[model samples]
Target: MRSKVLITGSSGKLGKRVLEFNEGLSFLSPSSKDLDITSETSVNKFLNQNSFNTIIHCAALARMMECEENPNKAFLINTQGTLNLVNKVRDIEKSCKTNIRFIYISTDGVYPCINGNYDEDSPTIPYNIYGWSKLGGETTVRSLENFCIIRTRFFDPLNIPFSESADDIITSSIEIDRLAKIINFLVKDEFNGVLNVGNEATTEFLRYISHKPNLKKCKRSDITKNLNFEIAKNASMNISLMKKILSS
Candidate 1:
């Protein structure tokens, strides 16, 4: 039988891409309006109605400024909301008596890199409520034995030109399409446990923005560092794990 994969936040950028790539596969993609992940009852009802072998959690309050301004909402959705789903999954799985793969989409913001690159084991210092909330969700997912927590760092394709800002710290990023492909691998249990995925090089925001000739340049100094805590001058990731996967 084909695997039934359920993806939350199907309306978002990454989720949309994942659905498009796996259009042929058995997928249950639902938007936030269709499913309230923050509500236990809603999650339970949805889980009960659907027989899914895999659940890809892509739902969360992710905008940095928004999360900072509304910390409560962030916690409710990113942290507690994730717990509700995990708990419901555990409960539903008992009667179903089938193994379910729980895939969590996490961010690289959890790491506090004010001066350098971060590895899988690097000390994580979430500089803002958004990061903290995501970390909280990650902790909840870790408690599950049959789960894959993937930490990704990338800016979605804005379609606009990348602006050059010298103060902008360089970080490893993956194109949305590329990241979707990697997630596809995980759906098949290809990798697990705190895997880091991104580009090998740490590219600056300005460099990326410059790729678009039509984009107007914004002064690096004009860009305000928007985080509660300080990070490394060069906070990037080591993509050896991703390299091994591609090679195999």
Candidate 2:
């Protein structure tokens, strides 16, 4: 039987793109309707039924506006939901003696550095509820010994139009295909820890949106002389760790 790699939040934009990477692998993607990750019973029951060697946690409450508007809902899905999955994985790994690689997709939003690049060692001081919830999920993933958490920034998804933002934040942005390729590589490698994954170079949010050459770009500084968002000015990760894996 082919080893199964299960992806949560398969209905989301990034998860859908990951399915199309065609990297000679088998993946099981469960839509939110099929898998209610927020429910502990649902998650545990599903994992029990399916045998998987890897779990890619892509499910998250991603809307910044919604998080700000209804923080309770965000906490339910982003924090507690993640805990449900992580705890289940830990129990299975302990009992079965099978190495299960758990990869949590994190965001650079957790870093509060307003004007500098952040690495794996950077202090995380999430400035908003959304970032805090994601960090909370990260803590759950970190507690597992056989897991790898990836702190990823904005990467343009395939076939989706990029949204424009004027913040001078620098992050390693890659195509969705590139990210999927890296994920495939991770499954075969012996890496078992936290790592940062992204493109070879750091790019600004404005440049990422403008890459298509058709979308209108707005300067964030012009609209909000005092920026309203609590995003880091430049919390890009150095993709050296990812590069080493890709080169090998």
Candidate 3:
């Protein structure tokens, strides 16, 4: 039988790319107006009315500085919002007597930036409120029976918003379109648990230089020194686990 898929945050950067790449697949991409993950009544109503075997949850308040400014708002939307979805999914599965595959788009920010090359088994120590809130969501997803928590870093190659790229900061960041393709593959596979998805480790400047030739180079300290919250210098992840799964 064809899988029934529901993608939340479809209007987001990565979510938009996911929809563009998977044009052949039939997916229910609901706007925020149609479904709000933070609202239990809204999520329950949407789930009850629709029959989706898989849910790709990409909804979150993802701005780092914004999250730091208002931690309460971050938790309410990123952490509690995820719990709302999980609860409704649990209820739906119990009532329908069927399994639901949950695909959660997490971040590499969950790891301490001091140490790079993190794997799925690495200890999670978030440096900022954004990371902490996402980690909270991950914890709830981990408790679910059938779920895939993807810790990845991706940016749009064509539309990088930054005028200057950080030369000091490093990460295993992949192009948004590539990341979307990998996610598409994973959603159809029988994989569960956490996976770090990204390309080989590289500096932010090098990653964006090709796309933004005139992009100025700046140090991480230069940017973070003005900010109140701490920033991770090295948040690169080991993508061997993701490679193995995709290869197999």
Model 3 vs. true fold: TM: 0.97
Q: Which candidate model has the greater lDDT, 2 or 3?
A: 3
Number of clashes recorded per candidate: 13, 0, 0
How high is each candidate's TM-score? 0.89, 0.88, 0.97
> Residue 133 of model 2: what lDDT?
91
lDDT tens readout by residue for model 3, 1-248: 57678999999988888888774467999998789888888988888888878888998999999999999999988999999999988888888898999999999999997879999999999989999999999988887899999999898888889898798899999989898998888788899999999999989999999998999999998888899998879989999998899999
Q: Write the per-residue lDDT of candidate 2 for residues 1-248, one digit (tens) a residue.
A: 34478899888877876677736557888778767889888898888888888888999999877887789998899999999999899889888987777888887777774655567778889888889999999999889877777777655643435445554556566666677667667766778877888764444544565455555555546545654555555666667777776677
Q: For residue 192, what is the lDDT in candidate 2? A: 81
lDDT of every model, 2 decimals: 0.78, 0.75, 0.90
Count backbone clashes in candidate 3. 0
The TM-score of predicted model 1 comes to 0.89
Instruction: State model 1's lDDT.
Output: 0.78
| Deviation from truth (RMSD, Å), model 1 | 2.5
Give the poorly placed runs of model 2, Cα more than 4 Å off: 157-167, 200-206, 222-228
